[model samples]
Target: MHINPYGEDPVRLALDLINDPPGSASELGRRCAAAGLVIDVPPGAADLAETNRFLAAWLGVVDAPDETARAERLNALLAQAAAYPRLTNHAADGWHLHYRDPDRPLAAALRALISVGTALHLSGRGMHRLGRCAAAGCERPFADLSRTGRQRYCSPACANRDAVRRHRNRTAADHG
Candidate 1:
């Protein structure tokens, strides 16, 4: 049923924010809008700082050593966000459930969305669906949204680069 909306877009947004953090509150707002989030508060310096703190913790979930540790870290985040789900149709066209209260500040809303979205992603997709890039020298985080759930790099560029590096090494080893 595409029940998650691909982790309901929040996971990808979280990743984007982590990988390339916004330099300013305005930029953050623009990026959130680009990602389809309806920000209730205009992003501010405090929002930027809070989001940074949240991402720092969220990255921990990405780098967790095992499923148990990962769950533990994510649980911490969920507890901090701690909001009851309520249905709303702010757009007035379609109604959907929201994990946070109505008209929350960007930072507070992000806390709920990223935490809850990540929980859904890990549970719905797989515990191993989040990780750092497999490409050597690139430690960026990635959410494995692949149909096969075998993704190893944050982007196609990293994957191709790693493949090329492997091929070159193999060729050199064969000649040596």
Candidate 2:
């Protein structure tokens, strides 16, 4: 069965691309395929550029001042990639919903996929679920898909580093 491709997977893929973008379209295609976004059209130079542009705009949603601003930014993305939802077995896997027209290149597909997926993620989870890491030295963006929705760091390593730093500072102050 074909798993739904428009939720957490797309958000994670967006974060991966935003954090460390592919240097070439081939790499982008490879990464997307790995992330369960196997589109019909292969990624090319144009797709690479378009994906980079989309991610730049998406980052604004991550860094918005508040939920109102965040919703506004995400709405713009949804508007740009707007397509009537339709069902198809275009890939011959099974019938499923798509937010964009079929046979579009990787960039066009990603635009719709990421935007809608993010909307579902934030609306389904919480607007506060997307943000930069709370760790002092790292401001990297992340989508908090955790069950508790209290994610504040980009990764476990960052969480550990920040915790250690906090503990050391507290100990030094207490001893002083």
C-alpha TM-scores of all predictions = 0.96, 0.94
Model 2 sits at a Cα RMSD from the real structure of 2.6
Candidate 2 per-residue C-alpha lDDT over 1-176 given as tens digits, one digit per residue, 9 for 90 to 100: 33243678889999999889899999999999988776789888999999999999999999999999999999999999989999988767898888888889999999999999999888888899898998998999998878888999999999999999999999999999
Question: Weakest 10 consecutive residues, lDDT, candidate 2?
Answer: 1-10
lDDT of 1: 0.90
- Model 2 compared with the native: what TM-score? 0.94
Compare the candidates by TM-score and give the number of the best one: 1
What residue pairs clash in candidate 2, if any at all?
A: none
After superposition, candidate 1 runs with Cα above 4 Å error: 1-3, 6-8
